[model samples]
Target: MELQQMRYVVAVAETSNFTRAAEQCQVVQSALSHQIARLERELGAKLFERTSRRVRLTSAGEAFLPAARQALDAAERARAEVAAAAGEIRGRLAIGAIPTVVAVDLPAELKQFHLRHREVRISLRSGGSEELIERVQQGTLDVAFLGLPLGVRPKGVHGRELARGDLVAIVAPGHPLADREHVDLHQLSDEPFVDFPPRTAARAQTDEAFAAAGARREVAFEVTTVDFMARLIRQGLGVGMLPAAFVPDVPDLPVLRLRDAPARMEHLIWSRFPPSPAAAAFLSGLGISAA
Candidate 1:
C-alpha cells in the first residue's frame, strides 16, 4: 500500500533475517519485524517463517519477494528520473538556430557542449530569426541562435546578446568587388543582389543599412539559405550580404566587410526558465567573444 511497506518487504526478503535487514536499513530489529508482519497481515498471507535459529520465506513469501523487489526497484528508478528531469546532469535539448549559425558556429559550440555532457541529446533546427523567435515563444524550441533583432518586441522570449558585427558582402574571388578592401552600398546600388526574404533579419540589416546611407538596391535574387546564396554569388548571379562571420571554405569566394554599411545584430534566445541544466551549461560554455 505504501512505498515504506514495499521497502520493508524487500529488505526482509533480501537478508532473510529481521535483525540483519534492520541493521542494513538503519532501523531497529523489532520495529522492522513488526512492520513486515503488518505488511503480511494486510496482504492476508504470512510472508516469513521464523524459528529460534533462523528466518525463511513462507510459500507466499517466496512468491511475493520478487514482486516486492521489483516494486522497490521501480520506485527508485522513477525517483531518479524525476530528479534528473528537474536538474540532473543529462537529458534531451531542442534548440532553434538562425540559418547563419548553423553554417558558422553551431557545429563547434555543439561539439564542446557534448564533450562536457555526453549523456545529453541535442536537436537543432535552422530558420530565419522571426520564425525561430516564434518557435521559442510557442514552446516548440528550448533555445534559439538569432542573428537579427526580433522585428518587433517578442513576448515570453528572452535573449542574450551573443555577438555584434557587420554584414559582409560576399562575391566570387574574380568578381570586381573581391579585390577591394571595402565595398560601399553605392557600389552595389546597381549591381544585382541576393537577399534574405523581406522582414527577415538579413533583409532588415541589408535594406536599412544601405537605405540609411542613401544607397539603392538592384534586386537580382532572393534566397534564404546561406550556402545556396553563396553558390549563386560564386556564379556571379548576384552578390549577397551575409553575417560577417560566414567565410566559405572555398578560396574563390571572398567575404568582404561592408565598411560603408551599418552593423548587423546577433543574439541567442530561449524560452523563460525553467532552463535545462544543459542550456545553462551551453551558455556558460560559449566564449566571451560570443557572449
Candidate 2:
C-alpha cells in the first residue's frame, strides 16, 4: 500500500526471516510482523506462507516481488540521477559474474573500476550463468558479467560481449596429447570428459561441438561447478572442455580443438535501466562491447 510497506516486503523476501529482515531494516520484529500483516490485509491476498521453520512466498508474493523491487529501483535511479546532476554519484551496487570471468579476468577489471569510482560501493556475487541470469531478472543485481554466449536467454537486460575464446581441452601439463599443435576431438574421443552438466546452455554448445565433429566424447564425469571439473581434470579423472581463459595451462592436458565448436563469448551485462554516473563513467572507461 505504501512505499515503506513495499520496502519491508522486499527486505522480508530477501532474508526469508522476519527477525533477520527486521534487523536489516533496523526495526523491531513485532513492528515488522504488524506491518506485514497490515500490508497483506490491504492487498486482500496472502503474500507469504509462514511456518515454524521457514517463510516462503505465495504465488501472489512471487508476482508482486519484482514489481515492488522495480519500483524501488526506479526511485533509487531517480535519486541517483538527481545526485549526478549535483556532481555526485553514490549507491550500493550488486554485480554478478560466472566462474570463468570471476576466476580468469574480472579481478583486474573490477579493481580498475573500484579504483576509479571510490564512491560506488559494489557487492559481487558469483554463480553459474543460469543463477546469475535469474538474479539479474529479479533485480538482485545492478549488473552482471557472466556467460558462455549460447547459455543465456533474452531477458529485459542489455549485454555487451567482452571476448570470445575457443572451447579448449584442459589437461594436466604432463599429459601425452600436449605435443600436438591441434588435438582434434577424435584423438580424445575415448578419453573421459569432465563437462558442464546436461541441460545447461554451455552444455548445449559443448554437445554440439562433439556432435558436429562426430566425436563420441565419453562422459567420465559431469559437474555443475567449474572448480570441481578443474579438480577432476587435475586428478586425471577426465579432461574438461572449458573456455580458453578458464584454463591457463593448455599443456597440462591436451589442448584439443573441437572442430567447428561454437566460440564461447564472455559478456558484460547489466539491467537496461540507466546507470549511475559513476557506473556510466566506469563503463565508458572500460569500453564494454556490444558485439
Candidate 3:
C-alpha cells in the first residue's frame, strides 16, 4: 500500500530471507516483518511462504513483484525529475554492456559522469548483447552497449550503431598459418577452434561465416571469456576469430586478417521510453541525444 512497504517487500523477495532483507533495508527484522505483514493483510493475500530454513515467494508475491518494481521506479524517476529541474541529477543509473565492449572507454566515461553529478549512483553489469537489450527493454537497465552480427538491429528498444568491423583469426606462434598475412574462412575452417557458447551472438558471427563459406569448424573449446579463449589459442589448443579491436588483449598471439570474415556491429541501446535523468546526462556526455 505504502511506498516504504513496497520497498520492504521487494528487498525481502530479492534476498528470500527476512533477516537479510532487514539488514539490506537498514531496519530491524521485527519491524520489516511487521510492515510486510501489514501490507499482506491490506492486500488480502499472503506474499511469502516462510519456513524454518528458507523463505519462498507465494503465488501472490510472484504476481505482485513486477508492478511493485515499476511503481518504485516511477517514484524514483519523479524525484529525479524534480531534482534535475533544480540543476541537479540525483538517481541511480543502471548500465549494461557486453563483456567485450570496445566502442567506448567505460571507465573513463563513468569517471567523468561521477565528477559532473556526484549525487547520482551508477551500476554496471555485463551480459550477452541480447540479454542486455532485454534488460534495457524491461527497465532493469537504463542503457546498454551491445554487439551483434552485421545487418542485425536491436528490436523493441532505441539504439544506434557505434562501430562496425571485420573479425580476424588468432593463432599460436608455431601454428601452420601463423605467418600468413591473410586467410579466408575456408582455410581456417579445418582447424580446431575455440569459441563462445553455441547459439550466442558472438559465436553466431563465426558460425554463419563458416557456413557461408561452405566450411566446417570443429569447436575444441567452448569458452565464455575472451581471456580464456586467448589462453587456449596461445597454448595451441585451437584457433579463434575476434573483432580487430580485441586483438590488443592477446597481443602475443598471431593475428591473421580473414579475407572472408564476419563483421560485427556495435551499438548503444536504451529503453524506447524516456530515460531517467541520470541516463540522459550520461548519454549527453557521450554526445548522444537521449530519446
Q: Best-fitting candidate, measured by TM-score? A: 3
lDDT of 1 by residue, 1-291 (tens): 677777777777778778788888899988887887788878999888889977888999889876776676456545546756776656556788877763236788788888878877888998888898888776557688877643434456767666676677778768877888787788878888988888887688778877888988877788878778878888989888766665554446887777675565567787774555555566667632112
Clashing pairs for predicted structure model 1, backbone only: none
Per-residue lDDT over 189-283 for candidate 3, one digit per residue giving the tens place of the 0 to 100 score? 78999999987889999899999899998998998888888988989999998899988877899999988989999999998998889999999
Give, for candidate 1, the lowest lDDT window spanning 10 residues.
282-291
User: In candidate 3, residue 149 scores what lDDT?
Assistant: 98
Error of 1 at 98 (Å): 1.6
Encode model 2's per-residue lDDT on 153-172: one tens digit a residue.
44777877677777777776
Clashes of 1: 0
Whose TM-score is higher: candidate 1's or candidate 3's?
3
Off by over 4 Å in 3: none
Deviation (Å) of 22 in candidate 3? 1.4
lDDT against the true structure, per candidate, is 0.73, 0.74, 0.92
In model 3, which range of ten residues has the least summed lDDT? 125-134
Cα error of candidate 3 at position 288, Å: 1.0
Stretches of candidate 2 off by over 4 Å are 102-104, 130-140, 147-157, 173-181, 249-262, 271-273, 288-291
Candidate 3 collision pairs: none
Model 1, residue 119: C-alpha shift (Å): 3.2
